[model samples]
Target chain A: MHGDQVTDKNLCLALINQLKWDAVCLTSKILECDDDRLRQDYINILNRTFAEQKQAFDFAKQHGWYQPMLAEQTMIGQVQSDTQKMVNEIQQSMMTMHQQAQYQAMPQQQNLNMGQGMGAFQHYAMPAMGHQQQIYGGSPQQYYR
Target chain B: MPHAKGKITARELLDLQSHLMLESNLVGQFNHFARECTDPQLRQMCESFARSRMDSFQRLAQHTNISPIQ
Candidate 1:
């Protein structure tokens, strides 16, 4: 490639990098959004951006302008194992919390069952309301109803 | 279904504005690159990207109006 063409290719790569960054920022925004419609719109735009990014990447690669390095098998394995370990730790913590909540609610549930009968207690009891609030950052009513 | 029929929250408005800015910038960059590139294939790719970004920009811009929540 000529010097000017090389410069153009480098600029194209830079633009592609910008698109990748934009996609990341858009994804974060989507996660933060509360409105379903707005979130869907953002998701649609994100999908388009991803498709265009892929096209730009392929074009650069086809023209011998950009070549990404491949990760080694060992490095890939290490990342996979690390991710699995983190997931396991999160699961274990969640199970412990769930068990503790259930244990704390057992006495209250039993009292309600005995006083109001099993059917009424089942209808009115919200043993995990507090735990749900803690996790969801909202009132029990907002979640239950 | 109708578009933006529900009331737009402040957060959603901010997100839309941010996306509009990004899309506009992308459209400009892609159009510029398309014009500057000497290779036909690269030029076509850049033009295509510019068009897509422009479409996104228009779609996002349409949501800027505030409406009553249904």
Candidate 2:
């Protein structure tokens, strides 16, 4: 079949994909164990898992839900992680903005003495500001004159 | 060559094994094709009978911290 794409390759690849998705997690649990005997035992367990995978692939051909479920599961997990990251980033930005606003307001607050003034500027003026544009020793009359 | 960062993915390991198997088959198929293949380029393809075959099992074993099952 020169130039004719091998159809079996597609099926075989599909089988491999199914095997990886279905069994990889379970296999990893066994593979990750520290015990060598247990790891070998896990490898041995693959015979059943592989057979079951082939059987499931055949079943899924008619049911048609296998690959879609696997793909959807991964995407859903991805969306959740992405949304969590976005939320964290937004919160971080808000915190930074709040800090910056507090810093900017600190100098202004000190000059105005918002704490000591306590609504004094609303309807009343401070004695310091009331002292007009006279030098320290000059009287108000001399300044006005 | 760019090095990979992060734990070796199970899917990646499986894919590597799958590709190795495919290449081995291709090497076997090439012997016959070398005789029949009219294209000089295709005829020049190399054959490897488990000689240069690389398996992910060893690397996987190292990463997983276990003796290779193979």
Candidate 3:
């Protein structure tokens, strides 16, 4: 179709799409930039483009040119629950790994005696372990006896 | 302003040149679209977009010391 022959609505819709593309391109440029100054400059431009794109989109929507379906509440709730569960699982795994690392950092003799008894090792290693914790800047937690 | 402290690289110069061109072209296109628009609201929106692009173009040109012509 000839450029001039396109209807106003079609032209506006096309401009909206072009703005979306511009936003994506600007985001990529910001991410790929190595220079701090250039990155900041791109970030500013991206922010302005985002605002303009939203304005354009709202204009189109208000005019009935862009009508998107509203998402179901149930779907949103399900996604929220799923995300929370995944986050909790990740945190549990990280805690377990951190405990393992602390255990490995302990003296081998203490580790061997850990299964049999706790009183002796606790008395022997407490001060040294406290020092180690200070050096590592990790909070001390009681080991399960 | 950030460009004041350090020298701009050759690659950065090229990137700024590209941005300036894009922004100027966008300003032209938006203005053209605004003139073609029959609805007052749509025309106003297009004009706003054109002004925004022009602002971006001027900002980049000012900061990078790269004129649109140069």
Candidate 4:
């Protein structure tokens, strides 16, 4: 059968369902058997059933109904590696941008430290304001100076 | 002459046989799914399931002294 014709998930499930029933029947038979030699015979039957199931799977894999597990794992590993690389790149870019921002702000911080009276005056010293406050504390007429 | 006693009890044998069958079925199902699934993630899931089933089967077989036919 063509690959496209056998790709149906339901069909595969149905096939597996049938196999499950067969396995259950074999299990029952194996459990009921008392003779050791006969038990081994039942075990053989079970193994044969399993082998047949495996063969069905092999056929499905050959027809491309499913992908090989190793190949799929390799694909997953590749995707994980790619995603990790992308995350690393993003982290690197973010770190670079942070560093650049810090570098650009350094000059401005130094400029502000040079007694530039701008924005909030927490760090800036108002020398003239200090003089006027001292004079006002002493006398109103001395406040003019 | 007296017959030699079996290494394991009948109940133990039944349990072992039942589990073996169950695990074998699971392994077969997962291996089938691993091979049949088109999606990479799904295929991986099936493959791991198959491996785990086989592992469980091996462990049980070892404890029960029942050699599984590979």
Candidate 5:
């Protein structure tokens, strides 16, 4: 495509960075900018430039041009993290179920004695048949640890 | 037309970069003095020239992808 016809996200961000850099340099060159009015005037131009970009973004929402490269990358990363978390939960649940099956296959009397292992099953909702959580702090204080 | 007869030597190529560095130095000197200058108009004018030179130097550095002389 011709350069004029190609509206790329990199080109857009590069243009914005250049414009913002120039605006900052111009503002720095101003001498009496300490005056509130002058400062506000200069700031307004900078703000308007970003505001223009925002309007462009909104207009291009249908074309997906409005989705910033940073935002897109972040969303992809979040999805990966969520998928990993789901996979981990699945694995943990499977392990727990397997251990219960193994225990159930053992002498039924041992399952009755399972209540003594407070460090283990209390973490899960089933609580391994009966000791209370108040003994281990139910507040999820050890939740992260 | 501008005259160009001989091929420029590698040394000359290096010298050209050196000259650009000197030009950048001149810009810094002018800026240093401009900051100390008491006359508002002259100081502003001098500083603006320095700024333009710095911009030029930065453009050249960016174009060549080389460090300007320290």
Candidate 6:
């Protein structure tokens, strides 16, 4: 295929590699277990898992999903770039979500500021001798005294 | 390299990679199993299993005309 053309098959294969790695890790952990009973139990589970995996592989083969590569290194490079693009898109979406959350929080912040303003008026403006005296119909100096 | 039956579909190519990847992983697991086993006979069995997996990996890689597992 062309260098820019990253087919679905390419992506699927790359992801399958991840599953292969998981199987490898599980097998290693199973082998490393010290208890004989536990190891045997793991082996039993692994056997069943392998059987399932084999079925899937067989299905792929039967459906013409497995084919040998003839000659094309461009596919590999295309897959790599496709993966990179996917990563970038994910990062961009995360950033957009973060910005959206911040935007959502701004209205609440403004409401908080409004509450604080009311608190300032109550504590400072109402308690001022000049203002209190004016309201009470007395001299500001007398009210201070 | 074994000649493919027809114009290989993208899906088939991907599946082939999956097969090779799994075989490579199975080899690694077998090697690990061999290392962890204390009994000589069990270790030998694990070692042989690993070898067989490697052989399978080589065959898969060969179909793709890629270098065998490192």
Chain B TM-scores, listed for every candidate in order, come to 0.81, 0.44, 0.83, 0.78, 0.64, 0.82
List candidate 5 stretches off by more than 4 Å: A1-145, B1-12, B67-70
For model 4, how does the per-residue alpha-carbon lDDT over B1-70 read when each residue is reduced to its tens digit?
Answer: 1113565557656756776677777788778877776757546646764775676567556645456547
Which residue pairs show backbone clashes in model 1? none
How would you class the docking of model 6? Answer: incorrect
lDDT of 6 by residue, A35-74 (tens): 4443454455456446534543443455466665675689
lDDT of 1 by residue, A1-145 (tens): 6665546677679768978988998899899887776687779989988988898888788878889899999999999999999999999999999999999989987776464434334445545455445545689788768
| CAPRI accuracy category, model 1 | acceptable
lDDT of 3 at B25: 83
TM-score of 5: 0.26
Candidate 2 per-residue C-alpha lDDT over A20-46 given as tens digits, one digit per residue, 9 for 90 to 100: 553574465565554454345445545
Tell me how much of the true interface, by contacts, candidate 5 captures: 0.00
Name the top TM-score candidate. 3
Any idea what lDDT model 3 has? Answer: 0.76
Please provide TM-scores, in order, for all candidate models, with all chains considered together. Answer: 0.63, 0.23, 0.67, 0.32, 0.26, 0.31
**Residue A62 error, candidate 2, Å:** 20
Q: Return the clash pairs for model 3, or none.
A: none
Cα lDDT of model 5 by residue, A1-145, tens digit: 4576423443334333444454454345233333343344335544544554354344345446455545578899999999999999999999999999988877755654574456565456355423444555464445436
List of chain A TM-scores, every candidate: 0.53, 0.32, 0.62, 0.34, 0.30, 0.38
Q: Decide which is better by DockQ, 1 or 5.
A: 1
The CA-based lDDT of model 6 is what? Answer: 0.57
Candidate structures ordered by lDDT, highest first: 1, 3, 4, 6, 5, 2
List DockQ for all candidates: 0.31, 0.05, 0.42, 0.05, 0.02, 0.03
Superposed model 4: Cα runs more than 4 Å off: A1-145, B1-7, B66-70
**Clash count per candidate:** 0, 0, 0, 1, 0, 2
Candidate 2, DockQ to 2 decimals? Answer: 0.05
